[model samples]
Target chain A: MATALENANLLSRAILTTQKLRISVSKTFNHMKDGIKVSQDEHGAPKSFASQLQEDLFLINESFIELEKLTMAVRRQREAETIGNTGALSMDPVTDKTPLYPKALETYKWATRLREHSAHSQAFLNNSSIKRSSGSGGSPAKRRKTAPTNLNISTQAVDNLVMNVNRQFHDVKITKIQLNPTVLQVYVSRTLQAIIVLRGLLIERVLIRAHHENTLNDDGTLDLWTASKYEVFQKITEHATAASLRYYLPTMQDLSFRSFMHWLNSFSKLFSTPCRLCGKYIKDNLPPTWRCFRTVEPYHECCRP
Target chain B: MGVTCVTQWPVTENRTVPQAVEVLTKRLDALGASKSGNFGVDCETYQSVPTNVPLKYIHVMHNKEQPYTCYAVTDNRTCLVCENSFEAIMHRLNGFYVPKKTARIESKGTRYEMGDFIIKIGIVSLGPHARGVLVEVEYTPCVIIQDCWPLMVEFMQGFMGAQYTPNTHPMLANKQEVPFNAEDTVFQYLEQFENFVKRGSSTATVR
Candidate 1:
C-alpha cells in the first residue's frame, strides 16, 4: 500500500510539472511572437530590415530550444503516468536523479533569459543604429539640430568675406558692406557698388557698376569709362549675360557637376532666339516650348499656338 | 562729442527783446566772449497729403562754424548730418514732403569762451517778433554729461545769477550718466525748438 501511494505521488508531481511546462512553453511562444512583432514595428528605416530578420531568426532558435525542452518534459510525464497505471513499484533511477520539476524550472529560467536577452539587444541596436545614421546623414532630426549651427557658420562666413573684401580693396574706401550668407553687397567710394554671390570661394553671379555720374579721378589719371575697373566689370557683365550665369549658380554646398552638365545639355537649344510670330526679343524667363514648332523662333505665350 | 545744454532765458522786467540781448551780449563781452558766426535752426513741418500717415517735419539746422555738414532732422528724429545741403535733400523729396510750418529761430550774439565752458546768448526771434533768449552752454572738453554737469551749472550760475536756476533739459535729465554724442546735443536743440514752436506764435513760411 505504501509503495503504491509513493508511485501515485510521483506520477501526480510529474503530471503537474508537464502542465506547468506546457503553460510556460505556450507563454514563451507568445512572448517570442510579440518580440518579433515589436522588432519589426520598431524598424523605422528600410535599411534595418535585414538585421531585424537575423535577430528574429535568432530569437526563433532560442524559442525552439525551449519548445524542445517542454516536449521532453511531456514525454517524461507520459512515461511516469504509464508506469503508475501499470502499478509498477520501482521508479526509473535516471528520472529520480533529474526530476521533471527541476528541469522544467531550468527551462523556464532559460526561456525568460532568452526573452530578456532579445529585448536588451533590440534596445541597444535601436540606439546605436540611430546614432550612426544621425551622425553621418542629414535626417530631419539631424537637420533640426544642425540648423542653428548652420546659421552661425554662415554668419562667420560673411564676417570672413567682409574681412577679405576689406583687405582686397583697402585703397578704395568701402562706405558700407552688408552680407547675408549667400550674397555680399559693397558700397565703395568713387560711386562704385558691387553685388556678389559666392559659391564657395568662386564668384558665381556678380554685378559691379558705377551708380553716380562718371567723374574724372582727382589726379586726372582716368575717367570712369576709361578705367580698368570699369572695363573688367563690363567684361564680367557681358560674360554673365552670354553664359546665363544666373542658372548655373547653386545655393547648396555640394555642387553636382554631372547634374549641372545634364541640365546644360537639356537647356542648350532653349535660349537667345527672337520670336518670329511676335517679332520681339525672347527672354529665357519664358519656357523653351514657347518657340514655334516649324520656324524654330521663340514666341510670347499669347502668340504661341 | 561734447556735452551741450539748451535753456530759454526769462523775459526781463522793463527790458525789450533786443535790449535783453544787448545786456546779455555786454555781459558776455565783459567775460571776454567774441562773435564767431550766425547759427540758425529752422524746422519745416509737413502733413502727409495722403491720409493715414502721420505728420512729418524736417528740421534743418546749420552751424556756420561747421560749414561742411548740413544737420537735417527727417521723420526719423535722429539727425542726419549729411555732406549734401538741406536744399539738395529737400529737392530730392519735393513731391513727397511739402513744407507746412517753418520755425525761423536764429542765434546772433557773442559766444563766451571761459576755460572749457563755451556760452552763447541768442535773442531767439519768430520772423519779426523776438520771442525769448536762447542760452546754449557747452562743456567742450567733457564727453560725459555727469562729469561736466556740475561745472556747467556753476558757470551758468555765475552769469545767470540766483534769480534763475537752469534745469537740465528733459532729454539730458534721463541720460545724465551716459556718454554724450552729437545726437544728444542735436536732440536738446530740437526739443527747445519744439517747445518754442508749441507757444502758438506767428510762424514764418520757408521758401
Candidate 2:
C-alpha cells in the first residue's frame, strides 16, 4: 500500500541510525580505557571518553540524520520531477533554506559513509584491539575470534622439557663418593648445578601437586598440574643449568648421592615426618610405639635409618 | 658488568581477551562514538594507544642468554651488571616484583641515563628531606611519574594478569631509596670498578 518512495526512505533511515550508534560506543570505550592514545606514553595527549563518545554518536547520528534528510529530499525532488513541478517542493514548508530534497541527499551520502564505518568499529569492539599490541606488529586487524580454549595438553610441554633436562644433566650419580644426606657440608661446585638444585625444588613441588589429585572433577578433567607449560619449565631449567655451568660447575661432592637423598627426604616430608609408627614423634631416633613393645624399634629401618 | 637485577619476562607484555574488552570499553566510552544500533564500538573507532605498555611487562626487544645490563656510575668510575650476573635479582624481576625507580632530577639535570649497562651521573638521589631529589646534574623520573603512573599501572594490571594486583602490588605510593646513597658512594663504586678490573669481573658474592 505504501509508495516506492516511502520504502526507500525507511531503509535509508534504518541504516543511518545503526551507523550512528556504533560510532558512539566505540568512542566511549576508547575514553574509558586510556585516552586518544589508549596505550601511549606519558606527556601524551589525553583521550576523553565522554567527549569521544559524544563525537562518535554525533558523527554517526549526523550521518544517519544526513541520510534521512537526503532520502526525504530525493523523495520530494523525485515527486516534483514526476509532476514537472520544480517549484512545487520550493513552496512546500519544510524550511525554505534547506529544501527537503537537498538536505536528504547530503544526509544520505554522509550517513552511508558513516554506516560503512560501523563495520570497523564493531570489529574493534569484538577484537581486543590487537592494533595497539607491542612488537613490530602491523595495523589493526581482527585475529579470528578464538576462545582461549586451547587443547588441554596431558603433559605441559614446558614441564616435560624441565623434566627431560633435569634427568639429563642432574640425574647422573657421581662416580665413587656417595652424598651423606644428614650433613649440610657438601662442596657444590658448578653454579649451573646449584640452580638445577634450586629449580628441582619447584619441579618436585609440582610433582607433589600432581600426586595430590585424589578425586576427579565432575567434568572429567583431573585436578592435576597438567598445564602444557610444565615441560617448557623443565626445558628452561635444563637450558639455564647448561648455561650456568660455564661460570661454575658442581663438584663431585656437590653432586654426591647425599644431596640427592636430602632432596628426596625433603620431598617426602611435604606433610610431616614419613609415616611415623609412634603416636606423634617423626624422628628417626624414636622407638616405634604404634602397637606392641617400644624398645629401639625403628621398624622401617632400611629407609628411615 | 655485573647484573644486580634481571627478569626472564623480557620486558614484554601479553594481550588477553577480557583485558582487551576492559580497555576497549573504557576507550570507547571516552570517545562517545558508536554505531547507531551496535552495543559498542563502530568500525572506524579503533585507534592504537601510545606507549600503552607498562615498563614492567614490556619485554626487551631481543633475547639473549645474558640479561639486560644495568650500570651505576660513581664519582670515580662506572660499574655495570648484566642480566646473567645475578640469579636472585633476575628471579624477582621475572617472578613477582618489578622494581620501579622514584626521585627527582633537580634543576641541574641528570648526569646519568639508563643506557647499555652504563648509567653515568654525578648525583643519584637528592638528600632525603630535599623536596626535589636530584638524579643527574638534574633529570628526574617523578616529575613525569604523576602523569604516567596511572597508565603504567593500568598496563601492568592488564599485562601482569593474576600477578597484577592484590596478588602482585604494582602501585608503589612510596618507593624506597637505593641500597647506598648513590651520591654518597663515589669512592666505593670507583674502588669496586678497580677491583673488578683487577679480578676480571665485579661479581660481589653477597651473603
Candidate 3:
C-alpha cells in the first residue's frame, strides 16, 4: 500500500512536469517575439533577450528530464507490484479496486479461447479434401475460361426481363421502371403494390404497400422508403423479403424473377384468405401475411408455427 | 383511421337498456374481445338565437379516440373538423348561437379489441337518461369500406347475430369505394344521436 501511494505521487509529479514543459516552450516563443524585456528577473531587473531565451530553454530541458525520471520511477513501481502479485493474482493490484481489471481479464481469456478454436477450424479447413469445383482446383487461366460469363447484367437485359415477366403474369403489371438506382413499381392484381430495387441483376430490396396506399410521392416519383400504413402490409413486406431470398438463383435469374412474381400473385387473396391453421380472418392485428414458398398456402405469421 | 361502421342496436321489449348492453358485451367477451379501456363521444347542439335568421343546428362533437380534434357537423351534413380549441371559439359565439342544454347526448362505455377489430359497446344517453345502445366496429387494417366490409360483417355476426349485424350503413353505402376517414366516423355517430333524439323518451330510463 505504501508503494502504491508512492507510485501515484510519482505519476502526479510526471503530469505536473509535462505541464511545466509546455508552459516554458510557449514562454520561449513569446520571448522570441516580444524581445525579452517583457519579463523581469527575480531581482526586478529587466533581463536581456539572449539570457531570457536561455532561461526558458533551461526550464523546458529540466522539466522534460524530471518528467522522464518520474515516469521511469512509476513504471518500475508498477513492474514490482505486478511481479509480487504474479504468484496469486495475474492483474495489477491497484486496478483490482475497480471492475476494469477483472472485466479486461475475462475479455482477454475469451479472445484467447476464440483464437484457439478458430485456429483449429482453419487447420481443419486447409486439410479437408472437399473440392469446390474441378476447374477451381486447376490453373487460374483454365478456371477463368470455364467460369460463367454473364455475371454483370446489362440494362437492356433487365428491361427485357421486366417485359417478359409482364407478359407472363397478367396480374403483375410493371407500372414504372426508374434508372440510376433501378426500381420497379409493380401493381399485383388489385390487392397490393410492390416496389423492387435492383443492383446489377440482383433483387436488392422489396417493399410492399396496400393497393389503397400510394406507392408514389406527391411529385409523381416512385416512393421507395415509406412503408405501408397498415400492419398487414408491413408484415407482408417482411414475408416478401424472405420470399425474395428463397427464390434467389444467381445462375437462373429469369426463373427466380418469375417465381417471385408467382408468389406475389398469391397475395391477391390477402384480405380474402383466412389462415389455414386457425381459419380466422385476422390474428394479432394482422391478416395472413405469410404465404408458403412451395404450396402458396396462406398462414398468419403466428399460425405458421 | 380505418373503416368504421356505427349502428344503433335497438332495445327489445323483453330486455332493458343495460340488459341489452350486457348481452352484447357477454357475446363480445365470448368471441375473445378483451376490454382495453373506456371511450366516450358527446355532442352538444347549438342553434342560432335570432328568430329572424333561419334556424340552423351545429353539432359540436368530441370523440375520445381523437381527443385532440373537435368536429362541428351542421344540419346539412357539412362537417368542419378542427382543433379542440374550437370549443372555446364556439363559446365565444354565444350571442349568435345559444346551446340547447336539454339536447345534449353522449355515448360512453367499454372499448374492446379483438384481433384487428376495435369494438365499442356504448350506452347512448340523452341528458341524464339512457336511450339505446350503439355498437361501433372498426376493421383497422383496410381503409376502403368495400374491401373490408364483408370481413367486418363476418366478425360482427360472430357476436351480434345475423339479424342484428346490419348491412352496409346508409352513410357508407355511397362512399363504399372511397377510403374512409375520421370524419365519416363522426358523421355516423352524429346521425345515430339524431335518431335517438327523434325517437324521444319512449324507451329512455334513468341509469
Candidate 4:
C-alpha cells in the first residue's frame, strides 16, 4: 500500500515536471523569435532548459511504467481474492487439452476467417469506382435486393456454421438471420440481436444490442447501441448477473464466444429472478412478469400490479 | 438525459384556448398527474447584415426548464447550446448578426408531474393572438426513444384523447439510441414554432 502511494506521488510529480518543461520549451521557442540567437553559449541557460526538458520527459516515462506496475499488482491481488471466493466458478482455461467439438471448432475458424474477407472486400471497395456509379440516393431496399450473391459465399458458409452451432442448445433459437459480405446480423431467440462485423482475420467484433418484441422496426432490425440504450442494457444485465452467477460468467479480454448458443444462453440470466426490485431470493419461482420496457429490470407482478 | 415528445394541438371550432387547456389539465389531474407550475419556451431570430458578413438567420431559443443554457443555431448550420453568456457571445459578433425576423412564439401553461412522466399543456401565443396549443410529454427515467415512446403516448392519450396521436417525429427519426436531452426538447419546440411562422399570420387564419 505504501509503495502504491509512493508510485502515485512519483507519477503526479513527474507529470507536473513534464508540464513545466513543456511551458519552458514553448517559452524558449518564443525567445528565439524575439531576436535571441539560440546558439548563445556564453549564458548557456536556454540550452540547459532544453536539455532539462528531455530529462523530465525521460523521468515521466519511467514514472508511468512504475505507476502501471503498481496498478497491475493491485488488480492481480483483487482478482486472486475473487477467484479464491468463487472456487467452483473459475473460468475455463483456453489451453485445456480436450479438443473442442468438431462442429464448434469449424464454426469458430469460419467466423475468424470472416475478418480477413471483410478486409479484402474493403480493399476492393477502396480501389474500385463501382460505388460512384451506384448513385447517392440508392435506397436501402434496393441495396439489399441488389446485393451480389457471388460476393457472399464465405458469409453464407459462416451463417450455416453459426446456425448449426446454435442447434446444439435446445432452448436457444435463432429467429432471423441477415448476411452481407462483411457483416452478419442475427436475432437470437427473443432476448438479443447481435451484429457481427469483421475488423480483420483476428477481430470478430460482436455488438449484441437489446431487442424487444413490440419495438421491432419496420426493417425488423433492432436499434443499435446509443449511449443511453447501452447504459440501460448494461445496468439491467449487471443487476441480473449480480443476482445470479450460474448462467452469466464474467467475460475476459479475448471475448471469444464459444458458439452462437453459448452467447444466446447468457440472455436467460437477464430474466433470472428473485426480482431485482423486491430483492428476495425466491427459489424455483415463476419469472417476474413486468419488465421496464427500456432498462428491462424485472419486477414482481404484485410490485408493478 | 430523458426522452421528450413535442406535438402541437391545432385549435379548432368551439374550443377556446383556456377551455381546451383546463379540460386537458383536469383530465391529467384525474389520472394522478399533479401540477408543478407554469412553463414557457421562446426563440429569437437574427440575420447577419450582408455588407459585413453572410446573409443567414441566427436563431437563439431559450427554455424555462433550462434557464442557464441558450440554444443558438447559426446560418452556417452550426449549433451551439451554451451557457447564459451566449448573448454576450452574440453581442461580440455584432458585425455578423443583426435582428431580422424576431418572432417570440411562446407556450404559457401549467406543468404536470406524475412519477417519471412530466406533461406540459401550454397555450402557444404570438403577441396577443393565441395561436395553438403545444403539449410536451417527457419520460424522465428512460432515455431511449423506443423504450419511452409507448409510455409517453399512453400518458398523452389519457388527456389528449384521439386528437394527439403520436407520430414518428422527423427530428427523432434515426435517433433511436441517442439520449434525448434539454437541447433536443428545445429544438423540437423551435421546429414547431418555425412551422407556425411559415403558416402565415395566426389571426388571419382564425378570422
Instruction: Quote the chain B TM-score of every prediction.
Output: 0.82, 0.18, 0.92, 0.87
Q: How accurately is candidate 2 docked according to DockQ?
A: 0.01
Candidate 2 CAPRI-style tier: incorrect
User: Per-prediction DockQ, in order?
Assistant: 0.01, 0.01, 0.19, 0.02
| TM-score ranking of the models | 3, 4, 1, 2
On DockQ, the candidate that comes out on top is 3
In model 4, the fraction of reference contacts reproduced equals 0.00
Ranking by DockQ: 3, 4, 1, 2
> Which is the leading candidate under TM-score?
3
User: Poorest 10 consecutive residues of model 2 chain B by lDDT?
Assistant: B38-47
Q: Give one digit per residue, the lDDT tens place, for model 4 in A41-127.
A: 567545555564565566556655655554555422212222243423233355255334334446657988998899999888756
Better of 2 and 4 by DockQ: 4
Residue A41 in candidate 3, Cα distance off native in Å: 96
Per-candidate clashes come to 0, 131, 0, 0
Per-model CA lDDT versus the true structure: 0.53, 0.31, 0.81, 0.58
Segments in model 2 whose C-alpha atoms lie over 4 Å from true places = A1-163, A166-210, A218-221, A224-305, B1-207
Give candidate 1's error at residue A292 in angstroms: 98
What is the lDDT ranking, best to worst?
3, 4, 1, 2
Worst 10 residues of 1 chain B by lDDT: B198-207
lDDT by residue for model 3 over B99-194, one digit each (tens)? 986999999999998766899999999988999999999977666676666667767777888675685676555653667889999989998998
